[model samples]
Target: MLLLDLLLMLLIAYGFGFLYYGLYRNLSARVHGRFGPSLAQSFSDSIKLFVKEESTTFGWMFYLGPVIMASGAVLNVLFIPFLNQGESLQGLSSYGNLIVVLYLMVLGPLGNALGVGSSGNPFGVMGVTRGLTRLLALELPFYLAAIGVMIDAGSADFGIIMQAQSTQSNMFAHPLLFAAAFISFLGFMGKSPFDVVGAPQEVYSGPATEFSGKFLALLMSQSAMFSFAKLLLMVNLFWGGADHLGELVAKTFVLFVAATFIGSVYARFSTVQSVEFLIRIPTLLGIVGLALL
Candidate 1:
């Protein structure tokens, strides 16, 4: 059962990732009024990446970093509830909690930082520095918002939070938290307005520039996995995980669409702008939510 559950979580994450990749292509094509690649383009790209020769200037740690990051993402997904009354798998929820999940979310980036730093690429190092710097401001609002949820629900356990939301969705009770989290979520998703860390214009894909071949494949997979994990976290926190897969998908899609729209409409912010905004506005709102709760 454990193995099966793990497989199911990974499969679902990968499937969603593929869908998002397709959405990216189709969305871009529509934006420009041009034809786009097939929906399976991401899958083909992954296949090609996997088969490509491994290239590394760093060391085995660089190779291992992405693997660890991807593993963390898969584990994170397995711990989040996708449907109420259903756990990722029996016994898996024993260790799952808001605190642990938040740490798990950071695990991948930490690994990437170490690996990228070891590479000695100026851009990779710069990107890593920028990412960690931005994380400081982004984290405060998210933490405050999470604390508001804990106060409203009376526990840090994600399952309990969901049960509490089942009575009344947290979104309604703590709209301020929802706003703060949504604001942080924009940064978490690495969308345009908060995407300074990996800006191609300045950093040339940032930490990922030095990676190619199998290493690139692992990084890409982990990125998608992280994206899905973030979405599931939002679903659990705001949408109650729904009662069925279709509902879950629909709600998740709506959230993603909101994110996409926000990402598209806003111009990219400088790292300083991102940090300043996160600290000043969302932080205040999160504190307000905590007070209200």
Candidate 2:
């Protein structure tokens, strides 16, 4: 039964991850005053990539990159509970806490970086450097906000935190912290302003330059799953965990839409600008919020 639950969790993560990404592209298109591809387009693209063979191979390291990335995403999905309830719906939520989920979120990107580094492509190397540079700045504010929440609950456990929100969700209890985390979340999602990592222009000279065919496909699928895991983390932390599957969808969709809309309107920042903005704004807010806590 536990194994079945775990498999269901992975299926949901992968399925909804692709669906949400397709929604993002659609939302981005509408905001830009243009029509986008169908909602299934993301899945279709993944299938196409799966069938296409890579023309060049950079050895075992490159092959292991996407697998490592996907593994992190899977762990994240398994760690976070889908609904705030008994041990049944919770996957491995009993065994882990918010801290573990946060760390796993970082693992995927770092894993991808290792693979990119092994490629010997200067562009991929540069992209990884820029991404890791942003990542370092990314964690401070988020970690600060997370610490505040854990302190408030007097425990690092997700169950305890969610239960505390039975009266008032963290969004209201700690708006500043949520705001700080939300900003970091946007950057984490590779959204605009902070999306300096692999924007189309950046990718032309960035990480995706080296990967092709199945490698690229694996990256895309893992990215989608990782993104949904981030959404799940935010929902669990800020909104309080949902009561049912329907409630879960609505909460995550609203958060997803808010981020997508914000991403669409904002211009992509340069690497330096993104790093500075994250440090100055979100980090400062997190500091103030933590101080209050």
Candidate 3:
């Protein structure tokens, strides 16, 4: 029964994740005054990559990279409760807390970095370096906000946090913290102004430069699932977890649309610029939010 629930969760993550990705492209194209591909284009692309004739690898480590990344993503989905108060949708969330989920989030990227480094691709290494550098600053405000949430609720448990917000969602009770987190969340979604890690013109696809065929397909699949996990995290933390699947879709879609529109308007930031901006602005908001708490 537990395994069946887990499978259902993965299916939801993959389905909605790709749906949002395709919507992101379509929305961005509209902003640029051009028609975009259909909403299923992302799924089609993933299938095409999977069926490609060949893929390159740099030995066992490289081969394991995408697998490890996918594992981390899957673990994240499995550990996070889909509903605020329900046995049906909750997976292994009872066995973990926010801190555990936070640590799991970084596992995939770190594993991918190792594989990219071993692939002997200078561009991939550079991309990984930029990603790591950006992450240091990216995580600060988010961590601070998360800490404030946990402290306020007096527990690291998601259910506790959600219960504390029964009268008022965190987005309202703690606007400053939400502001700080939302800004950082924009970066987490790889929006413009914080998307230097994979700037095609600059890094030739960044950490993904050497990946092809099935490896690339696996990365895409993991990315879709990871993206949903991040969205679910924010919804649970701030918007309040949903009681039903429809409510969940509505909240996450609103958040996703906000990130997409913001990303479309801004230009890409240099690595140094992004780090400096994050350190100064969102970090300051987070500190102030914590102090207010």
lDDT by residue for model 3 (1-293), tens: 99899899999999999999999999999999999999999999999998898746599888787888999999999888999987877989999999999999888889889888889899999999999888889899999999999998999998999888888999999899999999989988889989999999999999999999999989998988998999999999998889889999999999999999999999999999999999999999999999999
lDDT of each: 0.82, 0.89, 0.92
Better of 2 and 3 by TM-score: 3
* Candidate 3 local Cα displacement, residue 285, angstroms: 0.3
lDDT of 3 at 217: 89
> Which lDDT value does model 1 have at 21?
66
**Tens digit of lDDT per residue, candidate 2, span 118-184?**
8888878888888999998999899999999999989999889999899999999999999999999
Q: How accurate is candidate 3 locally (lDDT)?
A: 0.92
Which candidate comes out best when scored by TM-score? 3
Candidate number of the best lDDT: 3
Model 2 residue 260 CA deviation in Å: 0.5
Of candidate 2, the 10-residue stretch with the lowest lDDT total is: 199-208
Let me know the TM-score candidate 2 reaches against the reference structure: 0.97
lDDT of 2: 0.89
Per-residue lDDT tens digits of candidate 1, residues 1-293? 77887787678888887788678777767766888898888888888999997745678787776777887887788777667776543225566788888878788778888888888899998998899888888889998988888877798887788888887787887899999999999898898799998899999988888999888888888788778788888888876767777887788888887887778777889889989989999999998888876
Model 3, which residues run further than 4 Å from truth? none
Every model: Cα RMSD to truth: 1.5, 1.1, 0.8
Cα deviation in Å at residue 88, candidate 3? 1.2
lDDT of 1 at 56: 59
